[model samples]
Target: MIRVVAVLALLRLAAITVAALPVQWVALRLGSSLADRLPVWWHRRALATLGVRVTPRGTPSSERPLLITANHASWLDISVIGSLGPVSFVAKSEVATWPVFGLLAKLQRCVFVDRTRRSATGRTAGELGDRLAAGDPMVLFPEGTSSPGDGVLPFRSALLGAARAAILDSGHTRVVVQPMAVVYTRIGGMPIGRADRHRVAWYGDMDLIGHLWGVCIAGGLDVEVVWGEPQIFEATTDRKALAATLETSVRDQLRAVLRP
Candidate 1:
């Protein structure tokens, strides 16, 4: 029965990828004005393929210059949140060169940054700010990498500088930073524990294809997306301090949501 489900998912994924072409072309041709309202369809398609149901908490921001910081759980985090609303992602620089996922990220207008190079940090943040100033809300995973569905990692303060630049220089003082937490709660309509969760969260050195295979054969993938209250960053606020606070809030939220 599980094998049958996995095969079905693989077929669905292939079809969705093909169907996204026209949508991508039209959105890009119009200067990406349709961009902020796009990608939800792809997220829906991804959900259908992966058998993952995302239950969102708290409302997304209604204003421009929004930054969403989510704890990275599985690769599925992308589709879960992207499916929630139309939002771009701040992914690692190597993602731009990845196989098929890279193209999808570019189509979604993702901002890629090279963490090893200090020179690129400002450039990447500038790009993020440019998108925000252009009224595009972006999602950034501050852990710099995905972790097992165990606990939220302490966020790196380096990337939070992007939020500071946008609010201070761009005159967008009230920019909203929405902290999000993703927790895989159940499988096959039953509760999943730490050992079983490995089928979902793909961490260090985990091969993508193998992870997908394992996930596909598993029961349903259920993710709880908890969005913390919207925080307004101003010039008077210390950026790093605010970032740390946001990190703690999100970590707490994740722990709360994951409590058994």
Candidate 2:
């Protein structure tokens, strides 16, 4: 039965992924260089098990301390980007409390920001700066929350201010603010439209179990990613203006991907 197979495949996928947690934790503690990409290999297999096809475009910068900013559609964003290269995410603090995913995020060494607590912002900003200075490429979803796959939401400027701080406080003008777009292109061999996006996008109030069930049961989903031009956050660049520019670039890519 379709239900049985989907459930079995999902359970198997989770089991394998969860089983690798301790190894990742040890790697993080041991200060191994392989720590950067070990989790990505795990994610590739897990995503392959789910029958999702991810196609990426352009190239992420190889330069040290790159800061990638992108639109958030679903929890799948993590696997999609993780499949690309060696990178960690800057996520909200609450992600650490989520059941399985929170654990995985920690294994991946994701930077957590408590957006509601003003004091936490400075602390998180310091961590981000340190990571950048240490030469780890970090990805951030500037929408501050995930949205339906219809289009990109206007990016918030608060978090982006951290990019500036990284350059000024750390004296590392080497950060690349690369903009990217993740578009869910198809489901069941047909192009997906706004009407069907909710199946992939996990907006607030949507039950995670039911959403994951819907995605796993669906046939042959397709995802396309566009890596836009990388821009530098210089001393003169205003954070709000930078966010608007990147948001436009991402929205444009989404429009192109949605074209018939």
Pairs with backbone N, CA or C atoms under 3 Å apart (clashes), candidate 1: none
Model 1: per-residue Cα lDDT over 1-260, one tens digit each = 87988998988888888778667868798867565555788788878777888888887778667888888978888888888877889999888998888888888889999988988988888888888777778898988899887788878877677557755677776677888888888877877788887788888888988998887877777788888888887667677787788889888887887774
Weakest 10 consecutive residues of candidate 2 by summed lDDT: 166-175
Best by lDDT: 2
Reference-based lDDT, each prediction: 0.81, 0.86
lDDT of 2 by residue, 10-54 (tens): 988978877778778888899987677788888788788788899
The deviation in Å at residue 219 for candidate 2 is 1.3
**TM-score, predicted candidate 2 vs. hidden true structure:** 0.96
Q: Best TM-score goes to which candidate?
A: 2
lDDT of 2 at 178: 91
